[model samples]
Target: MISGNRSKAWRIISWVIASVLILPIFIMLGSGLSATTELFSHLWDTVLPTYVLNTLSLALIVAILSSLFGVTCAALITQTNIKAKNTLRWLLMLPLAMPAYLVAYLYTDLFDYAGPVQRFLRTTFNWNSPNDYWFFDIRTLFGAGVVISLVLFPYIYMLTRTAFEQQDQNLHRASRLLGLTTFQSFYKVGLPLARPAIVIAISLVLMETLADFATVQYFAVNTLTTAVYDTWLGYGDLSTANALASLLMLMVFLVVLFEQKARMNQRHQSNRPITSSHEIILTLPQQILASVFCWSLVILGFLLPLGLLVLMAIEYASLEQIDELVSTGFNSIELAVYTATIATIIALVLVLYKRLHKDKLKALPINVSGFGYAIPGTVLAMAMLATFGPLDNYINDLAANVGIEEPGLILSGTIFAIVFAFVVRFSAIANGTISGGVEQISASIDLAPPSLGVGRLKGILTVHIPLLKSSIFIAWLLVFVEAMKELPAVLLLRPFNFDTLSTQIYQLISDERLEQGAIGAILIVAFGLIPIIWLNRNEDKA
Candidate 1:
């Protein structure tokens, strides 16, 4: 009876936690239903169709490009003797430090008509104006797709590289002995074996592509995310925006379901490491081609835009503005730290509970909590507003019923709401990182403490927590970088005067203050690059 009571108590606690996490979703659905049809009609006529088409095109382009770059680089570095394989591996993966939108901003700032590249071309060729040369339009769907691919490809690259690196060396040797060429070995053995990782990475890249707003908006390439913003704010149509968001959500849901089915259907046919021995020396022509490809990708993805940002920052530097930049930099670091701290704590608790209990009830909260990543920042912001709006009203009403004066303590328009939104949106990064760590641990280790008569909680702390130190650190860094770059959620949910680096950049860009925005955008990218470099270091050591 006492044991039954304890289990029931835990069940109730799980329910409460689950409800808190899922409350925003429920509120959004409820509020969306009540919004009028007039809003829907307005959106149907303007921006909706273009948004869907452009979004689909952008997503498709990014997926194809990211897959090509990721899979090719993985094969080159892992299966063959690519020159400077270690250097190429890190260079390929480092683009993860650059966000798609920031890339779009930086590229446009450098290559657009008034930017340096075009100006230099005009002066060199003695061309009179914009029409003289067929310079690429950096504000089109093509431009946005290219920029998105530059940063997003790293997702596929990192995953596929890991998959390739972990493959058995024996398989390659046997394939070669059987008279198979290196290319055939890769396709027949290496590629098939790494399919699962490639698919998962592609799905992630697709999800992020769908969720992106910054790149699409800046380039004026209308996508569903930008449409959600346009429908809600531009047309004053909440219902239509919600309906559109629901559609976007459904698309992600279908993709996720497909991924789950694919995972179940997958079979492990190989269990050996592909590159257990050192890489074989490539022929001179092959080596040259490999070097060229690696350098070109690295230059395009990392060096070029970063160099431009540095130049611009130097051009604008003055003793007075240095103090302002320093202050904003501190604020950015502080925001990133707090958001990472909160996200890691929540993710750690959820992971621990799920691992210890391994029950459907406990798993539900964490799973749904991670779904915040799939939802766009605009949709999440609306969900937050819908949740807090009524809660505040209810609190005030209750206070009135009790004849109390104030009830504004509810977190409606405060920094707490912004932080809460950040936690909800970013929990996926932390959860995935922690969960990946936990999965590496052997099952026998989990059973150790329980068999020895230690309670589940103590076992988790003493056994699981100790085993997951590296994962916890990675989770913190991932969440910190993501939070630092977060824009739309911060934009809508921030307090009356709050300004994080992301929000500050957005404000400057919106106001056509490109130089100032460039500075903030650069800082955001630099902070993001730190973790990517660390990850690369770890990969090299492995």
Candidate 2:
């Protein structure tokens, strides 16, 4: 009876936590319907069709490109005896450190009509102005999608490479004996078995693309996420913004449903132990080509922008602006550390709570919490406002009722609001990484502890956590990098006069002070790159 009661209490706590986790989404949906019906009509007439087509087209293109690049790189590094394969593997993932908006901004600075590339051409060939040549605009949809894919491919590459390393070698030998070429063997034998890894990576990229507000906006792309911002801030139409956001939610919903369906068809059995019988020794030409491919991605995604920033930092070395930048750097670092730590703690609790009870009630909350990672930051900020505006009033009402009212807590306009929004937005990263780790640990461990008469909490701490130490570290690092690069949510939600590196960069770029913005942008990327390097070192162990 005591054991049953303990389980029951834990179960109730899980449901309560789950409800709080999902409250933002439900609040957004509720507020959306209560807004104007004309907003819905406007969506159907003007923006909905274009938003749907653009978002879908971008997603499909990014998915294909990222998968090809990621899977091929993983195969080359893991299966083939390529020169510098170990170094190349980590270099491939370095692009994750470069934020999409920063990439777009730098490319624009490098290649735009008024920029150095065109200026050099004009001075060299005795050409005049903009009309002398037709330059490719980096502001187009195709360009934006390409830029996004370049940085985002690392997600697929890292996960799929690990999957390839862990794959069962017998499957490959069996396929080869049955008559398959090297490439064909990869598709038939390797790809199918790595489905789980591919699915997770692709889903993450899709969600990131959908959630991106800065990159799309900078490029003037009319994605649903961008529309969410334009409608709310540009037109001051909250109802229309919410309506557009609801449609965006539906798109996310469909994607989630498709994933569930696909997962249902998976064959979960004992994986054959992975081993390799044959390895390819690449020719010199092939080696050069691989080197170029790897370096090009690193340069385009990370190095060039960083170089520009270093130059700008030198240019601005004399001013107090450098000191100000350093101060803002502190704010950004502190916020990122706090956000990552809190998010990891919450994700651990949610994942463990769901795992221990094995009840639908607890599972629902964990799943709901995960949804926040998918929502666009702009939409999330707006949802926070809508939800909290009335909430603050209610708090004040209670304060008045208690006869101790001075001024109600202004949570929305304070640091508390920014941190809370960050947690809500980024909890998914921690949850996903930690949950993936939990799944890898054998369920038998949990049953073992109970059978041995250990307390449930003690079992998790002693057995489950020790096993997940590496994954927990990786998860925290991933969350830290993401939080550092985050801009849209921080921009919309931060308190007055409170600035981070992201906010500073965005402000400078928006004011057309490209040189100044490049400095802060570079700092953000540098911080992000630290984790990429760390993860690469840890990848073999993982």
lDDT of 2 by residue, 6-56 (tens): 477777766665566667667878878887877667776987789778898
TM-score of each candidate structure, all chains considered together: 0.90, 0.88
Which residue pairs clash in candidate 2?
18-365
* Each model's lDDT: 0.77, 0.78
lDDT of 2 at 152: 95
Top candidate on TM-score is: 1
C-alpha RMSD of each candidate structure in angstroms: 3.2, 3.4
Task: Indicate the TM-score of model 2.
Answer: 0.88
- lDDT of residue 427 for candidate 1: 86
Q: Which runs of model 1 end up more than 4 angstroms from their true locations? A: 1-7, 169-179, 271-282, 319-323, 326-331, 358-362, 400-403, 406-410, 439-467, 517-519
Per-candidate clashes come to 7, 1
Please report, as a residue range, the 10-residue window in candidate 1 with the lowest summed lDDT: 1-10
